[model samples]
Target: MQHLSRRQFAKAAFWLPTLALAGPAWAQTGDDPVEFVESQYNNIYIYKRGTQVSMTFGHNKRLYTESVMDTTDTKALPVEYTKFMTAAVAYTKKQDSILQIGLGGGRTSWYLHVHLPDAAIDVAEIDPVVIDLAKKYFAVKEEKNFAPVAMDGRLFLLRNPAKRYDLICIDAYRGPFVPFHLLTKEFYVKVAEHLTEGGIVAQNVEPSTMVFNAAVATMKSVFRQVDFFPAAGNVVLVAYNDAERLSDAELLKRAEALQAKYAFRYPLTDLVKGRREPSNPVKGQILTDDFAPVETLHAIERKNEKWK
Candidate 1:
């Protein structure tokens, strides 16, 4: 796992929804009236006139409800996402089961449903409002292959211990940032507990941000082998508990095969590069509930460009 700045990551992830909820300070702006809606205990401010959503940070940054559907954007489905999916597809043929932890605008969920028709997808989202908004505004459709589970991902995974998935995607984020509990060693181990043999966990980690280093450290503690794919200022961590190594040559060959099959834009070029020489090659620290301090690691990444 690596860390990246929120601003840099935001730029890289142009398709991700910007979080700028409305607050009392926004009410002071009398002329531009903003409607506020609370979802999952978070305040979401919608501009009464247009598609822009306001931020509570006092800086009025607006994001369109339509951009959420554009999975091609680096933020939504970063190049790393396509690469990880390619690898997962290669590894598990014949429409294996795929589980996604988060469903923001249903970008990855819809893409997987459309592309991997044979694969069964289970999407767990904490906020139904986001899911509903994605459907109303982002044009996210649900089909037989897609199962939307409105529940906390951690609790769901724990409850369904028998459920094993071939590919698991963890993209849970909290208002422009990843929640600290979700990035801990304990949580990752729980993720491992629900995985099938040879299954890979693809985690969307913002390395430049505060949560990046702790996430990497936590992931390392659970999986026997972990690899990174950097794209759009974010790192997608693919962890394998069963195998220590996945041959680079094999991975490249498979990537090429997938590109021909799917015609993906980013495909597997950069993923292959990361495999050769990773940014954080050695294990740094284990991220436990009490001991993890991801913010500090994020600060170090900001100072040292070598992590990239």
Candidate 2:
């Protein structure tokens, strides 16, 4: 196994203990926060604020929130598009089953389980620590209909040939970068393979990234139709397996139906209103497993060239 030098190792070990004194650290006085961190991926920070319990992944000088739950009620989704993700139920012809990638705090999966009790909700998570946090702190129950498996999202899809889903939600982010492998056309082809006829995929995308267009293009290569729904700063891409486009008028009708039946805390109509096609569908190069430049593109996006 590769080993970190004492100096390098200490950097990862440092400041974690100091934060506990900072407040609501996910550990007791004798416990260590370093235990929650995964190798070379993220330094996990778990904390609680009043009725909210949250998890953050710190990497590349940015602390991205992994998940947050309302301690008072797990059914109430704290994130905006998690409610929007339910919009998939509107677009898809069936709501029999779902495959959600990236368990995080397990709020999305939990919400799906509660709202669509009849649907089989399967969640594939890459990190055991994330799963533990969800169950222990976030109140995600494991029942017959709700299955939480510890596996990479892509591998989970590849391995489960017999299993198919009406909707597949992909929002797997690793540290500062969305996993390059997950953003590729080839991976989405696998995602398309796991879908039932008339199935749709709901993916949480970082529109701020320079590679956003490329990411959409990659998805479009596999799925016949792709639509974008604005969510705060991010966008959720709903890709349909069949070659058909849905107009805003059409989506609004569907959204209204879901909102009336479910009465989501955040009305599903906003997601419908936020709908639009890719501004530059062919702008960025299509990402592929063998030739993805996600990190490079992100770095370019971060670099402010306005001054130059």
Candidate 3:
């Protein structure tokens, strides 16, 4: 795996996908037609290309892929960030209760539900339309232990004060940006409160945006220890309240054990191997509920990058 610089990430997130879409191979053919389009929280589009089905949020004539799944193989995660997202399991030994903040196509939730049959999984998807499409087109289903709810992620945590999860996965995004409320220090405080002791929270962050550093800072404010796993244009941040940090060797050892036990499609060991130190003296202000300028920061960052 290659480590991308901030600028490289921006290019990959913005330009690479756009360029790919312009190519003949990516042009929408009769076989790759849009399956559904709805307007609720955002303008959502679901399309299929051969065996791959994807969910994209449309904004300003641009489409940002929120989730992708292989129709032929529901268990296969076609997105790179998703594969790394599952590596969150390597940080904790318990999988009794898991909470996912975003449901996208429910690929991550479905994958975890299948792999961890005994674990209880709760998913919070803000858009009810996405949940419906996820079930109809992506094979997301409510089973004995798996449940997907349509509600704001923060609200879900606030509503369930007594519920504590052993692992919390945050991959929530609206188009190219994360909901402002989800990026604040206050929200992370709530997230930390709902975690069981020694529990870990894994978040998928777009390193290209200005919010990236601030999001990291905000999580660090709430979590005692933070680690990074950079994959493609995204960096999965795994944070916990534990005082002692887990070393690379220890993480690798744990990943190896979990890999042997579960036989994951994307080897956990490969994901753990990409773990490295985050940027030093973390640059960016700690985001608070009272002052989390997510959209403004993203706009400014995009403008600055465009000229350079």
Find the candidate with the highest lDDT and give its number.
Answer: 3
Which ranges of candidate 2 are over 4 A from the true structure? 1-41, 260-263, 278-282, 302-308
Of 1 and 3, which scores higher on TM-score? 3
Give the whole-model CA lDDT for all candidates, comma-separated: 0.60, 0.72, 0.80
TM-score of 2: 0.82
lDDT of 3 by residue, 1-308 (tens): 12122323433443355446555665544323376576578877776655667777766666677777767789987677777789899888788999999998998888989998888999998999889889988998888889999999999999999999999999898877788999999999999999998899999988776787788889989998888877766788899877788988899999999889888888889888877675454567799989988877776452122110
Clashes of each: 13, 0, 0
TM-score of each: 0.73, 0.82, 0.88
Error of 1 at 241 (Å): 2.7
Q: Which pairs in model 2 have colliding backbones? A: none
- Would you list the rank order by lDDT, best first? 3, 2, 1
Q: RMSD of model 1, in Å?
A: 6.7
Per-residue lDDT of candidate 2, residues 1-308 (tens digit): 12121112122222333354335543344432323555444567675554666666766555566676767777876666666666666787777899999988887778878877888999999887788777888898789889999899989988998899998998898755678888898899888889998888998776655777778788878888877776555667889965568877887888788778777666778756666654433466788889998878876562211110
**How well does candidate 3 score on lDDT at residue 215?**
84
At residue 179, what lDDT does model 1 achieve?
62
Query: Whose lDDT is higher: candidate 2's or candidate 3's?
Result: 3
Candidate 1, TM-score vs. the true structure? 0.73
